[model samples]
Target: MRQNNHMLFRINLARRKFLRQGFSLLASAGIIGCGDSATTSATTPVVIPPDTDSNDTPGTLTTTSTPQQVVIIGAGISGLIAGYELQRAGHSVTILEARERVGGRVHTLVSPFTNGQFAEAGASRIPSTHNLTLAYAQHFSLALDPFYPSTNNYFYLQDNSVSLIDAEQHINQPPWPGAVNRSNFYKIRGGMANLPLALSNALAEHINYSSPVELIQQTNDQVTVITGQDQQFIADRVLCTVPLPVLTKISFSPPLSEEKHLASNGGYDYTNSTRLYSQFSQRFWHADNLNGWGDSNWPEEIWQPTWDNGESSGIIQSYLRDVAATELDTMDVEQQIANVHSRWQHVFPELDSYLLTNHIHSWQQEVWTGSAYASPTNLQDSALSAYIGLVEGRIHFAGEHASNFHGWIQGAIASGIRAANEIHNAN
Candidate 1:
C-alpha cells in the first residue's frame, strides 16, 4: 500500500521544519555538523556484568529466569552491541551475519604488511567525541593510539606541486563543502576489526556467521525471521541493524509502512566509496619526513596506517569517496593501482620503488553492505530520519544511518543501545 500524496506532503513539511530546528539548535550550540573534530566531554565507562551461564546453542539464552528472545539481523557493530546488551539482560539473542565475518564496515587487512603491521580497510579512525565507541573499547580492554602522528605532511592538490605543512596547519586548513575539520583521530591497537571480534567472541555461541536474513514476518505477538538458508528464528522481537539499502532486499511479510519504504528505497545516500591499502617494504615516505597523509585534486585522501605502529614496513591507504569512487569502480584493479601509484609518484618520486603490493576494498562491491555509510539526502522527508530508529511493532531499526551521528562507530553503538533499551523496556 502506498501513502497518500497529501499525507506525504504534510510529512515533508514537518521534516523540513524539524531539520531547520535541528540546524538552529546546532548553530546555537556552536556545532557546525557531524563527523567533525569538536571536543566532546569524556564520559565514565559503565561496568557491564559478565554473563555467568554458558549456552552452546546458537539461538538460546541461559538465564535463571526466561527472557524474551531477540533475533538481530546483521552482525555489524550495531547488531552485535544490541545482541550483547540483550544477552547481558538475560534475553536470548540470535545474530544473523551475511558475511562469514562480523564487523560490517570495520574491516582490517592483517597479512598484507610485514612485521605484524596491518591496515584498516574500513572505519579506521575514532573521534574523541565518539563516547560510546570509546566506552565499548574500554569495556573490551582494547588499546587505542593516535591515528595520525603530529608531524609535517605533504599535500598535492589537484595536479599541483607538493607542499609541506605541519599537522596544525593541515588540520586548520578549510575543509571541502559540507566537511568539518578533523583534528583528533584514534584507532584500536590491532585493527578496527577487534571491536566487533570482541563483541562476537563474547557472543560466539549465539552468533550465526554466513547466515543472511532473507525475510521478516511479524504477527500480533511473535516475529519470525528467516535466513537465506531457510533457517527460521521465532522471537518476541527483532532488531534490524542492517543498512537501509540492504534492508530493502529483505521481504517484510506485512510490508514496511509507506513512509518507511520510501525512506529505505530513496531517502538514504549510500556513499559510493573505495579504500586501497598499499604495503611498502620500507618507510620511504616517513624517511622523507613526510607524514604520508595528504589530499589531492584527484579527489582522493592518502594516509599512512603504520605511523604510530612502530613498524619499519608500512601501509599507505588511499580513500576515494562519492563521484571519485564511482569513477574508480569502472576501472580494473591494475589500472586503479597504477593510477594511485602515478599520483603518489608525482608527489614523491621515491614511492615508485617503495611500493610493493596493493589491496582494494570496494564497499559498492560488498553485497551485504551496498555502501560505505548512510547519509540521508532527503532530510525534508521527516519519515526518513524518523524511521531510522523507529520501532515498527515487533521490528526495531538500528544502525549508523539510524543514528544522528551517521558514518561513525559511535552512531552504531548509540543506535544499538537505543534499540536494546527499547526492547528491554517493552518486554
Candidate 2:
C-alpha cells in the first residue's frame, strides 16, 4: 500500500533507455512525489528492541527529561517503533490501535494458498540502500531474498492496445526506477509482515487492539486521549502516527494548526493503489521462459510474488495505481477478478486454463489508511506539507506521510524514531 513515492516508476522514455539504465531504489525528480528514500537521514541506526521482557534491563535515555507516560496512536510501524524506543528509554507507553491485527500497511497475506505461499498487501521491497530498514530487519534476524528473478526471461506488455512483448530483455524497465543494481533489491524471506509482527510481539501487552482513539485534547502540560469506548487515558505526551486522512476521523482539542487542517483537508495529495492477486493451478508462464513479472501499457506491474519460492502453482499480483486503481476500486471483489482475469488472459494467454482463486486489496479503501501514501500533488501541497511533522504542544506526528521517503519503509521507521526522540528529550 505504501508504494506512493517509489512505485513502478514509468516514463515515456525509449525502451532501450529504460533497460540500459535500470531502476534505482531511490526516486528520480520525485517521480511519485514523495522524494527518494536515499535522501532520508540514515546516519543513526535506529534500535527497536526485539522484545519487551519484564526482566529486561532498564532504558538508557540520554536526556535530562525524567520518565513520562506516553500514548501512541495507530499501531502501524511508526507507532510500534516509537512505543518500542520510548518504552526502552524508561518511559511508560500505551499504544492505541483501531485494527484487530497489527502491521498497518506492511501486511502479508498467507491463507487458502498451498505450500505456505503468500502475497504482500503493502510495503514489499527492502532496498539495500535503506540502512535503517535493513538494520532493523537484520537486528530481528530475518532472512532476505532477491526481489526480482534476474536470470529469467521477462514479459513486457508495454501497452494495452499493442500489448508488446520483449521476451529477449531480462526486464523492460530498470529493476525499480533508478540506476541501482537489480541485485540490491530484496524482500523478507517469509513476508514483509514479519518485521511488524516481531515489533508487535515485543509490545504485545502495551498495544490495545480495536481501541480506536476518538479524541485528543492536549494542554501545555499533558495530553488526554478518549477512546471510542469512552475510556479516558492521560499521557505526558502523545505521538500520533496515523496518516493524514485518518487524522480527520479523530477530534483534536484546540483543533490542529491551520496548516495541518489545510494539509489534511485538501492541500496534500496521496496516491491510490490496489493490488490484485490471482492464484493459478500451475506456473504456466515458465513454459515460455517468462518469469511472470512484467509491466503493461495499462501501466501496472504484474508480479509473481512467490516467484522465488519455486512453487509449481504461483500467485500473479497486478500492482495497480492512480487511474487503473481507481477503476478497480469501483468494482467489488468479483468484478475486480473479472477485470484482471480478462486482461491476464490476453496478456498471459493460457492464464484462463490454470486460474485457481483470486483476491484484491485496495489501499484507498482501508478504514485506517484512505490512500496508499502521502505525495503532495503540486507546489501548494508541498509547501503546506512542511507542517506535517511539526510538534504541537504535547502532541507529535510521525508516519510515512510525515517523512520525506513517503512510500518507503525507511521513511516510516525514521519518522517513528524522530518523533520518539522529540518527546524523550523534551524538557
Q: List TM-scores for all candidates, in order.
A: 0.82, 0.83
Please write out the lDDT profile of model 2 over residues 1-427, one tens digit for every residue. 1221122232112333322232122133121111112212122222233333322211123533489999999899888878887887778999999999888999999974676679998998876566567656645656555566554465666444423344324432356556355545667767899999988988988999898999999888889999999989999999999888778989999899998998888678888999999889888777666677777767788888877664668899999988899988888888888887777776688987888887888998999889898878769555876688888899999888887787888788767877877888787
List the RMSD of every prediction in angstroms. Answer: 11.4, 9.6
Residue range with the least summed lDDT across 10 consecutive positions in model 2: 31-40
Clashing pairs in 2: 1-122, 22-174, 23-174, 23-175, 23-177, 23-178, 24-177, 24-178, 159-297
Candidate 2 ranges with C-alpha deviation above 4 Å = 1-65, 160-173, 176-179
TM-score between model 2 and native? 0.83
Using TM-score as the measure, which candidate wins? 2
Instruction: Please give the distance, in angstroms, between residue 246's alpha carbon in candidate 1 and its true position after superposition.
Output: 1.5
- Model 1 lDDT-worst window of ten: 33-42
